[model samples]
Target: MQYKPASWLAAIPLAAMMGVCVGQAGPSQVGPDPTLPKPQRGLLPDMVIAKPAPWGDKTPTVPDGYTITAIATDLKIPRQTLILPNGDILVAEGKGGNAPNLKPKDVIAGIIKARGTSSVKGGDRLTLLRDTDGDGNYEVLTFAENLNAPYGLALVDNNLYVANQDAVVRFDYQPGQSKASGPPETVTPLPSDINHHWTKAMTASADGQYLYVGIGSNSNITERGMTAEVDRARVWRINARTGEHKSYATGLRNPTALTIQPGTDQLWAVVNERDEIGPNLVPDYLTSVQEGAFYGWPYSYWGKNVDERVRPQDPAKVATAIKPDYSLGSHVAALGVDFSNEAMGAQFADGAFVGEHGSWNRKDPVGYKVVFVPFRDGKPFGAPVDFVAGFRDKDGTTRGRPVGVTVDPKGALIVADDLSNTIWRVTPTQAAKSQQPVAAAQ
Candidate 1:
C-alpha cells in the first residue's frame, strides 16, 4: 500500500528502512518491576453474549477455543480504561453525542432537550466489573458516581488513580470494596484550563516510579492560540509519589492511549491527527515514542511535512521534526492500545493490539473493531490485522463501537465498547501456542 506524501516531490520510505529483526522477552519480565503490585485477583463480571448483536456487514469471530463474551453492557459513552487488580474494569464515560441508542438525525433534537447536556452530569463516573463464581470474573461490584470528566485510570498498590478533566486523583480500592462508599483523594492537579479540556491519558511506567500523562492540544492543531509555547501537544512524566513533572515528548495533536512496551521499555502512543483536511488526507497514527523527539503537529504532520492549510507561524523549526512509525489509514481515529505480552490465546505471541474507534470524517466510516499490529525487534510488522470485528451493519449503521483494549490476567483480549456500553472478551484457542509457524515461534 502506498502512502501519500504531503509534497509530491518528496521520496518514499521517509526514513531509512531498518532490518526487521525479531525476538521475545520472557513473559515473567513483561511489565513493571517486582515492587509494582501483582495482577489483581478481582472477579470480573461474567461477560456472556446476551442476545445476537446487530453485527453489521462483518461477523465478529475469535480463535476456535475462545469466545467473545460481554463483561458488562449498556454503558454510556465509555472513553479510556484501567483494569483493576480485582478483575473489575474502571471506565471513563465521556458525555453523550450522536450514539447507537439514538439515530444520528435525532441526535440534534435530543441534544436540545438534554438542556445542552445529558442529565448525566459531566462529572458523573462509574465502575463496571463482576465477581462471578469466586474466580476471575469481577461480576459483583458496585457502581460509583459523581466524578469529574475522567479519561485515564491506573492502579498503584491498593489505590486507584484517575485523571479527571483538570487533575489526577486517587481512591482507596479493595478487591471486594463497594464503589458507592470510598472517598476519592486528590493526588495532583493537572494542567487544565477551561479553554481546552486537556483530556488526560495516563499510564505508569514499568517500574512504577513514573506516571506519564498526555495533554492534547487545546484546539485542532491551533496550539491554544499561544504564539510562544507551541509544544502543548505533549506527554508529561510525573513523579508518581511527588507529582513533580517534566515534558516527556512534544508536538503530538492528541495522544489518547500511552503504554511502555514490555521488556524493551520503549514508549508508544496512539494519536488522533488534526482534522478538517480532506477526510482521507491527514492520517491518524500509532508510533513508538523516543524521548525528546518532537512529532510535528499544528506546524506539520507525518514528520516535518508542513500542512499548507495551517500557516506555520514558525517555519524555521518545521524541517527538523520527527514522524510516526505506523500509519493507521486516514481518519481511522486510532485510540486505545495494548501490548500482547501475556500469551493471549496463541495467534498474538509477540505484538500489540489497537482499537481503532472507527472514523467519522470519511464518507464511509471504517475502524469500528480491534486490530492487531504484530511487532518484531520492537517495531510494527507487515500491517495491522483484524483481531475482532463486527461493529457496523449492512446499511452502514453501527450498533457498537470499540474504545479501550487490554489483556486480562487470563491472557484473553478484553475490548471496551462505548456505544453498547459493554466489555467484550476474546478468549484464545487451546492451540494458540502450537499454531505459530515453527520459525516465527523460535
Candidate 2:
C-alpha cells in the first residue's frame, strides 16, 4: 500500500457520523448553546491542560476535574508502553535509537533493505525511565541494542519477554538493570516470513502465567484462509514459565491489544478491521477471546457472515467462525487497550480504554484519540464513549497519534503518542489522593 499526505479533515466524516458536530473555524458547530446545558467547566482546553511546554498541535479541551501533563519529551519514536511495579514506565520505541544518525535517504535505503531476510537493520530497542524525584525529568534508563522491530513487551517476575519481528525472546530483567542481565532466551521460534510480520503486539496475563501474542494476517484477507501455514491472523497464548505455546483464538486481522481482565482472568483483544471496503462496512471490534474459537477473518468477517469479495476462496469454512461483540468504526485502527479496574475513579470503574492509532486508508481520517467501552459483569454494554479526544487541531491537522495505553499504578491513564514521540499522563483529581495513605493526626 502507498501512503500520501492528505488533509486531516478527511476524518471529519467519521466524527460527523458519530453524532459529533464538526465546527467551522469562524463559528462553533453547535453555536452558543445558552439553553443547552453548559459544557461543564474544569475540563482544560488542549493548550492549558497540557502544561509547561505544550508541543505542536494546539491545546485540547477536556472534561471536568481532569488534567493532562506531558511527563516526558523528545522521545525518538515511542510505541508500546508498560508501567513497571516500581512506578517507572517502560517504552518501546520503534527504530528510534537510530534516528540521530539516519537521514531521509538512509530511511529509504532501510526500507529497501528490509525487502529480504538477510537484511538486518539495527538499533530498535531502548527504555526510558522517569526519575521524577531524583532530577525531576525523564531520561533513558537503558539503551538496548540489536532488535528487529521489537514491539510487544511483558515483564513476568524478573524476566522481560519481547516479541521481535521473527521470534519471542526473554531477557533477565533485574529490578534496576540498565542492560539485559543474561543471554537472550529464544522462547518461540516463529516463522520469520518477512511479508506478514505482525509479530510486534502482545500482552501478558496479570498473574504472569501466560503471554498473549498477536500475529496478524499477511494479507487483508488471505484467499486460502486465516489458518493456513502462512496465514497468521490469530492470537497465541504462551506458557510464561515453560515457553510452550498454543493458539488462544483465531480470525482477527490485527488484534493489536491482548489484555487479560483484572478479576476474572478473561482475555480480550481489540482488533483493527480490514480496509478498502466502503466506509461503514466491516466494523473494527473489541471482544472477549475464547479458547479454540475462530473470530471470522479472511473468508468471513464480523462473525460467521462471509465477506463476499474475499469469501469465494474458502466458501466451506465461513460456517464455523463467530462474530465480534462490539464494533468500532471501520478502519479506525484500534490498537493499544487496557481495562480500568475499580481502583481508577468512579467514572472508569469497569471500563476499557482503547488508543485508536488513526486511519490513513479512509476518505476521511478516523480515530486519533482514546475511547471507553463500558463493561457490566465483564461484558461490553451499549456503545463506546469518547474518553479522550482532540489529537487533531480545529484546522484538521494531527499533532499526535496514540498507540499504546495502560493504567498506571496510581490509576492514572498513560498514553503513548507516536507522532509527537511523547507519553501523556491523564489523572483525575481525588483519584490520586484516594491512593494516598491517611496523614497522621496533627
Candidate 3:
C-alpha cells in the first residue's frame, strides 16, 4: 500500500527530523526511578509505531505455568470489558473521535497512527459473551445496539449507565436479560466540544450512589487554549439518581480507566500522561484519585515538574501539584486497570492488573502487554511484573494490542485485544506452583 503524507506535513522543519535519533533509557529504568530527566524537545516527536500483524493461529505468550485461550473472537474494536454479576462478560466495542487537525504535525501523525490500527469498523454497541458450559468458550449475544460511541460501562442498582461520546445515558437492566427492552434515557451531557479525547472511563461508587467519569484534556498542552478544555482532564462525580455532577479531581491528562479498590472506598486511575517532550520524560501512572486534587497537566507533570512548553506558566499551580503513587513508564498508554481479589491464583491474589495499549510517541515502542503491580495494605508496593506479553514480534510487527482487563467470576484474567479482534482468558496452569516469576519488560 502506498502511503502519502499531507502536503503541509512536507513543510516540517529539518530540525524536527534531527532529533529522531535521540535515545532514552529503557522503560523499566524509568518506572522505578524517582529522579526524572529533563524534557527533550523536538521539532517532531519520535514516531516508531508497530504496524499491525494480525494473529492467524498464534496467541499471546503468558508467564510460565499460565495458559491463555480465546474466550471471544471477531469482536469489533473491543476497548473495554465488564464482568456482570451472573458471569456474563459485557464488552464495550466502539471508536469515536473527531478532533480537528489544527497543526501540520497533527495531520502527519494521524496518518501514521491510522496505519498501525486495524481497518475494521467499530461495532458501536456493547456485546455480551456468556460461557454456558464449564468450558472456556463463550456464546456471543448483542446486549445493546445503536450506541453513540459508547466506551464506559457502569451498573448501579438496576440502572446500567453507558457513557456515550456526548452524554451519559441510563438503561433499565435486569439480571439475566440478553438485551435492553427499551431506549435509554439521557442522564447528563458530557463535554463533547472538539471531542479531542473521547473515551470517558467511568465506574460507580461501591454503594451505587455516585458515578465517577474521567474526561481527558482536549489538547496536549492547551495549544488550542484552555477554553476548549472545560470540565476536561479531570474526573467528574455524578449523582446516580439525579445526574447532577461536579468535578471530582483535575489535571489528569488522560485517566483512561477508573475503578474503585475493593474493601476501600478509594478510587484509582490508570492515566496516560502528556507526550512529545522526550521518549522517557513523563511516565504514565497508576494513582489513587483524591477528591478535589490537582495532578498537573499542560503545566507540570508527575507533580511539580514544570513543562516549559505551556506558555504563561503558573508556578503557584505547580506548587500544589500532587505526585502519583506509582509510575507505569512513559508513553505506555495504559488504558485498563483492575484490582485483584480472589484472583485466578495465589500468585495474582494481591495486586492490580494494568493493560497497556502500547505507545507511539517514543523511538522505541513499549507497553504492548498486561502487567501486574503488587500492592500491600492498599498501596502499590513493588515494580510491575509481566503477566502477558509477545504482542509485538522481534521485528516490531504487532500481533495484537491489549486494552481492557478484568477478573472473571471464575477468578481468571480476561484481556481485550482490539487489534486482533479477540478476548483472551488467562488461568493458572496446574504446575504454576513450581515456575519462576516472569520479569516485566521495561
Candidate 4:
C-alpha cells in the first residue's frame, strides 16, 4: 500500500499483457486525427494521482514575453470565473457531486483521487475582485453567499445568471455593486438525481434570447444504469425569458466547460471523455456543438468506434454519432475553456485556452497544465500548445490543478487553480510591469 494502490498494482500486468500502445504518450495523441489505440480493460485503470505540494515561491511558467501573477489567493475551491462589464471579476467557488460509489473499485478510486486535491471545503459563495483605480492591485470582496455549489456565471444586459448544482439562478445587476441586492431566483431546475459529474457549465446566446447549460452524465459509463441518465450527457437550451429547456444535443459524456465562440452564436465545449478502457483509447475533445447533434457516448467514441462495455447497445445511435472537431488528447481531464484575444499578446491572441485538471488514470500523466488550442477561421486546426506549465513535476508532485480559464477584456488570462486555492492572472510582460490603474467606476 505504501508504494502503490492495490488496484493500480493489479492493473500493471494487464496493461502489459494487452500490449497497449505507449507511443501515443506525449503529443502524438493530440489534434484532429489522433491515433485511437485499441481499448483494454483492467481490474482497475492505473491510479497515478500526484501528491499535493505547496507552490511556496514558485509560479506557473509561461512563454516568453508573458507574466503570471497571483491576483487572488486563499480561495474556497474556485471552479469558474466571470468578468463583469466594469472590470470586476466574480469567482464561483465550490465543488458539488454526490454519486454513491457503485463498487469497491469506485471507493478506492475516490480515496486515491483525493490526494491530489486541496483539503478546503467548498465555499458555496462568490468572491469578487475589483481594480477600482485600474492599478493592477485588486481588492477582494464577497459578491454573494450561501449558494448551492454554484459553478457557472453569465451576464446578459442587467441580469446575472448563476448555474448552481441543482438549478440556474438569476440576480438583477447594476455593474459596480459589490454584493447581491438580495437572494437569487431560480431560473430553472437541473437534474440532480445522482451527480457523478455535477459541474453545470453555462453560457448565454449571443442575442441573449437563450442560455445553454452543459449537464454531464450521471455515471462514467452508465454504470448507474441507463435509467439514471435521463436528461444527462447533453447540453440544454433554455429560454432566457422563461425556465423552459430542451435537449440541444446528446451522446457527449461529460461536457465540463462551455462557451460561445466569440463573434458567433456557435456553442463549443471541452469535454472529459470516458475512462478505464485504456490510457489512450478515447481522446477528450474540443468541439463546436450543433443544434441537434450526437457525439458518441457509452456505445461508441470518436465517430463509429464501438465500445463493447455498453449492454443492449443501440447500433443505430452509434451509427449517428459524429466525431468531435478536435482532440485534446486522451485523459487530459479538461475542465475549462475560454477564447483569447489580443490582450493576451499576439502569439496567443487568437485561440481558446483550456484548463486541463490533469490525469489520474495513467502511468505517465498528461494535462496538469493549461493549453492553447490554435484556431483558423473559427475552427480549431492545429495541435494544442502548452501555455502554462509546471503544475506537476517529474516526481509526480503537483502544486496546482487548473480548472477554469478566463480571458479578460484587458488582454489577460484568469486561471483558477483549485488545488492551490488561488486565482492566477496571466498577461503580457509589459502589462505586468506597468500595472496601469484602470479608471475608477463612476
Q: How accurate is candidate 4 locally (lDDT)?
A: 0.87
Model 1 ranges with Cα > 4 A deviation = 1-59, 63-65, 96-123, 134-140, 194-198, 227-231, 437-442
Backbone steric clashes in candidate 4, count: 6
Candidate lDDT scores, in order, read 0.63, 0.64, 0.84, 0.87
Q: Rank the candidates by TM-score, best first.
A: 3, 4, 1, 2
Q: For candidate 2, lDDT tens digit of each residue in 176-236?
A: 5667755578888654453343445778887888988888766555643444435377888
Candidate 2: C-alpha lDDT: 0.64
Clashes per candidate (backbone, < 3 Å): 24, 9, 1, 6
Q: Which of 2 and 4 is the better model by lDDT? A: 4
TM-score of each: 0.76, 0.76, 0.94, 0.92
Model 2 alpha-carbon miss at residue 133, Å: 1.8
Query: On residues 181-265, what C-alpha lDDT tens digit does candidate 3 reach at each position?
Result: 9999999999988888999999999899999999998998998898998899999999989999999999999899999998888
Candidate 4 lDDT by residue in tens digits, 1-442:
2334565546546444232334236447887788887788776776676889899999999987788899899999999999998989999999899987777677667877888889999999999999889778999999999998999888999999999999999999997999999999999999988789999999999999999999999988888889999999999999987989999999999998999998999999989899888788689999999989999898899989998999988999998999899899889899999998767766676789999999887777899999988887787866677889999999888999999999998888999999999999988866433432111110
Candidate with top TM-score is 3
Cα RMSD for predicted model 3: 3.2
Candidate 2's TM-score? 0.76
Candidate 3 — which residues are off by over 4 angstroms? 1-20, 26-33, 433-442
